[model samples]
Target: MVSLVPSLTEAVAETLPGTLVGATDWCSHPADLDVTRVGGTKNPAVDRILALAPDLVIANEEENRAPDLDALRAGGVEVLVTVVRDVPQAFRELARVLTACGARSRPRWLDEAEETWSAPAPARPRTTVVVPIWRRPWMVLGGDTFAGDVLDRLGFENLYGTHPERYPRVPLQDLVDASPGLVVLPDEPYRFTAADGPEAFPGLSCALVSGRHLTWYGPSLAEAPRVLAEALRAVRR
Candidate 1:
């Protein structure tokens, strides 16, 4: 099997070790993972993937390109495409993928992750914020995104959750004008840092969070609530 999505790669590698023969270059978790690199998610090396001759390939709708997946299908490879717009969908898809990989039983970590999120939310009032995943042109988590849902569950209400675009590119001035109570920045897709992102919002509080914990929907989900809540609390302190 080969995985084009990083989170799915981690999930399969953990659930059914040694089953993955190839994975995209972006599959970074389980840091010691030593699999054949199949380029990237958006522009995967389809020829290299076909050369590996995987029986099945796993991909996410958002993380991978349709044309690349179609090319893999045209080459007679079975590709399992997953759609995950929110946390519940994440668990369902994870379970579905693992089951497809021939797991006789659900993985313990998946159960633990479900239990972790199923617990009641904290009593704190929701803090309205803007989550920026990229900069330069400036893009944010907008309407119906997994990351946005994750934050929503953590008491951080996304200011742009009603926007039509999933990841909207907004001008810097517009973000500032929104006047969000806080600005949540994840360290991926753009690698926002303390020095870089916080300066953009002079008066607003900024929370620098792990892109993996914030966005990934694999083994990391078990501990994401604690990891993200701590980041949010640290900024408030």
Candidate 2:
């Protein structure tokens, strides 16, 4: 796998084990796979793929850097891009994409993982979560983003419901005044960590979470829901 934007790349590495390669600034996984270091607007690793010459290369149309993708295509590579927008689309596309790429998915991984979230009970008071991928100034996920859908499924509402765009940047003061129940900093975009959460957004309950679990819509979805279920439980406390 040549993943310039992380997310599903980490999933492939973590779940499939030794199956990932060529990760960028966005990827997060165990340090076993021989990853090509490419990040911060410099893709030094694209030159490396020519000799390996694999059977298939998978990418996301929206996330993977385009120039590098074009370079790969120029090398007579068969590139298949998966653009998954929602949870249902995510699951449906996974099997087809994996099969197309000749990758076998473990049975029932998607359904079993998604089922980890109990149906939201009226009894469980909702937690308003803000999934911040950027916070230098501040950007939040709004409705219509995959992350927003994930939060809804996990039994929470986006505090930035009024924001029009899927991913919008706003002022930090407003975010603070919104008084989010939980401030979730993603591992990518902003790459916020557990240690960074409180220092970044002081005076709010915060947690660090896998951005891919909430945003990556691919075969990774099969495993992400369980990761989300675990995070949701923790956020509720």
Candidate 3:
């Protein structure tokens, strides 16, 4: 099978190993992964994927374009497209994919992920935060996103979580005016770093976090709670 989504790719690679014959270049987990790099998730080489003659192709509704999946189906390739908007949805979809692959037992990481997030969050004062996923033209986490739900579980309320658009582009000044107590920056989607993102908001606290932990919904989910808590706790006010 070929995986078009990075998180799904890692899930497949970790759970089923050699079943992954091809993946996008951005599927960077399992560091020593050896597979044909079709291309990036946004612009995967459909012809190359076809050339690989994969029995199945896995994709996500958000990460991959519908046209590409249509083109693959046109070539008689079976595709499994998953829709994951929140943590629970991710678990259900992962289970569906793994079951479709004929696994007799569920992966241990799945159980660990469930347990890690299942426990009730400790009582704490909620911190209102601005989470930017991209820079340049500035886009932020808005309504109904997996990342927003994860942050909510960690006692951080997304400032724009109820915005009409899921990832709305807002002016930096507007974000500043929102008076968020903290600005949470993820390393992927824009690669925000200590130097790049923190300087944008001088007085407000900032936390540079792993994009995988913040966004990915596979094995990374198992460790995200602790990793995110550490980054958030280390916030400089």
Candidate 4:
């Protein structure tokens, strides 16, 4: 099998080991993963992937492009495209994809992740927050996104959660005008850092978070809540 999504690639590599014949360069987890590198998620080397002759290629609607997957399909490679918008959907789709890939049984980490997130959240006043994924044009997390759901479950309300666009590009002034209680910045997609993103939001709190834990749905799910909660706690203080 070949994986196009980094999270799913980690999932496959960790769960099935040598079954992953090829994976994109972005699949960085399980650091020692010694699979054939097909290239990046958005621009995979189709010819290299075709040469591997993988029976199945795993992809996500958000992380991969249609043309690339279609090209693989045209080459007679079966492609499984997954759509994960929330934690529940992530669990459900992971189960489906793993089963379809002939998993002997459910991975224990998946169950642990479910249990970890399923536990009741402490009742607290929800803090309205704006989570920025990118910064050049200033894009933020919006409605129906996994990160938004994760934060909502943790008693943090996304200020832009109702926006029509999934990751809406808004002006810096508009974000400031919204007057969110906090600004959450992740270290991927844009690499927002302590010295970088926080400067923009002056007095308001800004949380520097891990992009993998915030958005990935693999084994990272088990630790995401804790990792994110710690980050939020520090920012909230």
Clashing pairs in 4: none
Write the residue-wise lDDT of candidate 3 on 1-237 in tens digits.
Answer: 999999998898889989999999999998999999999899999999999999999999999999999999999899999998888999999998887765678999999999999977669888899999998999999999999999988888899999999999999999988989899999999999888988888788999899999999899999999999999888865
Ranking the candidates on lDDT from highest down gives 1, 3, 4, 2
lDDT of each: 0.92, 0.65, 0.92, 0.91
* Candidate 1 residue-pair clash tally: 0
TM-score of each: 0.98, 0.74, 0.98, 0.97
Candidate 4: worst 10 consecutive residues by lDDT?
Answer: 228-237
- When 2 and 4 are scored with TM-score, the better candidate is 4
Q: In candidate 1, which residue pairs clash?
A: none
Clashes of each: 0, 0, 0, 0
> Which regions of candidate 3 deviate over 4 angstroms?
none
Ranking according to TM-score, highest score first: 3, 1, 4, 2
- Clashing pairs for model 2 are none
Candidate 2 Cα deviation (angstroms), residue 114: 4.3
| lDDT tens digits by residue: candidate 2, 35-74 | 6655532353566765556555666766666887788789
